[model samples]
Target: MAHQTPDLIVSRRYLRLDCLCLLLLMLSACSSSDQIEQQSRTVASASQTVLMALDAWAAGAAPTAYTVDTLQSIGKTLADTGAQIRSAETSEPTEQASLTKAVNDLSVAVTRAEAGLQADDRLKVQDAQQDLRLASRALATAYAKYFAPKP
Candidate 1:
């Protein structure tokens, strides 16, 4: 039987250390990729939601306008909700609550906007249309924040 020298044992230890380092690096890379993919999926889902709302509006399936105060309130809510979604990208809490708020606010806004369809208030309808467009744009912005690849 041949006896192994001390140098050989030290060399084996070094090799083990290198392998451990490589494994850690690979794990880090995988985690980063998962984060990016998750962000992309979130953005895509949000886009789909916005598109559905817009389609419903275009098809005359929803209200034409809302009471002035309701419109303003919903618009403001949508705006704030959008900001929160974007902020989630960098915020420590991940802004889950904010994203939920955005979805709920958008739902309410759609309801209010669609409620005015039978009133025949063209000007108010137009205003609601503008607000809806603004809300969609805000959603797009928030989506972009998550989906856009790092520069």
Candidate 2:
């Protein structure tokens, strides 16, 4: 067999390099998607916590301080995720849309929870509870549709 020329060897090296670069690119893309999905789950779980708080409040139980605190913590997580989203340079479509939807859903749920806290009326509490549950369900559905692994 003929020995390969130096130019042919150099060319082969670059072709492998090209393949390596492409594989890295694809993996990074997939990782970004996974991050988005994780972020979406955070938002959904936070929304669910808010809903749970509303339920406790409406059931005539003393306001759920733990749940309130959990919701607040989740709010902080969402805010951080928002910053990540704004700073991202990737062109991943699904993750971008997922991040946008998560933020919107969490914002609405938080607003409702804040309103409930501000209200002195029990009826207002009930209304806020209903709103929180509805919003949480919607957010969860969206996340599940886009990112959740199949059961």
Candidate 3:
């Protein structure tokens, strides 16, 4: 077999480098989209949990202490979700921006819910549930827009 020249070896190295870069780019894209999907689902689940807790509290089926605990737990989850939304490396900048807003809105609603629960104001708590539901819908809309199939 003939030995390869220096030029050939350099060319081979360049080809390998290009392949590695391409692989890394593809992985980065996949990771960004996956992170967005996961964060959206987590926020939706948290919203539903908090909304159910609010309903139970309104009906007097849930004690104030337990309802407060539930709100706190959901608040923590929303905080984490907000962080994920801010840091996610989305392929689409618009999608990223929309997600950030949605999470922020939801976080605010959670804070209001917690406050209302502590003050024993059922009206405020009910209003918070509506706010949270809307925020959750906004998140779902953004997520769907990002991942919707092309016609």
Top candidate by lDDT: 3
Q: Which number leads on TM-score?
A: 3
Write out the backbone clash pairs for model 1: 62-114, 63-113, 63-114, 63-115, 64-117
Better model by TM-score: candidate 1 vs candidate 2: 2
Model 2 misplacement above 4 A = 64-67, 85-95, 121-131, 144-151
Tens-place lDDT per residue, model 3, 1-151, is 3899999999999999999999999999898888888888898888889888988988989999999998888889889888987888766888788888998899899899999999988899889989999998998998888788746
Whose lDDT is higher: candidate 2's or candidate 3's? 3
What order do candidates take by lDDT, descending?
Answer: 3, 2, 1
TM per candidate comes to 0.41, 0.72, 0.91
Off by over 4 Å in 1: 63-151
Q: By summed lDDT, which 10 consecutive residues of candidate 3 come out lowest? A: 142-151
The TM-score, computed over Cα atoms with residue i paired to residue i, of candidate 2 is 0.72
| lDDT score of residue 77 within candidate 3 | 88
Model 1: lowest-lDDT 10 consecutive positions: 89-98
Better of 1 and 2 by lDDT: 2
After superposition, candidate 3 runs with Cα above 4 Å error: 1-5
Looking at model 2, residue 106 earns an lDDT score of 63
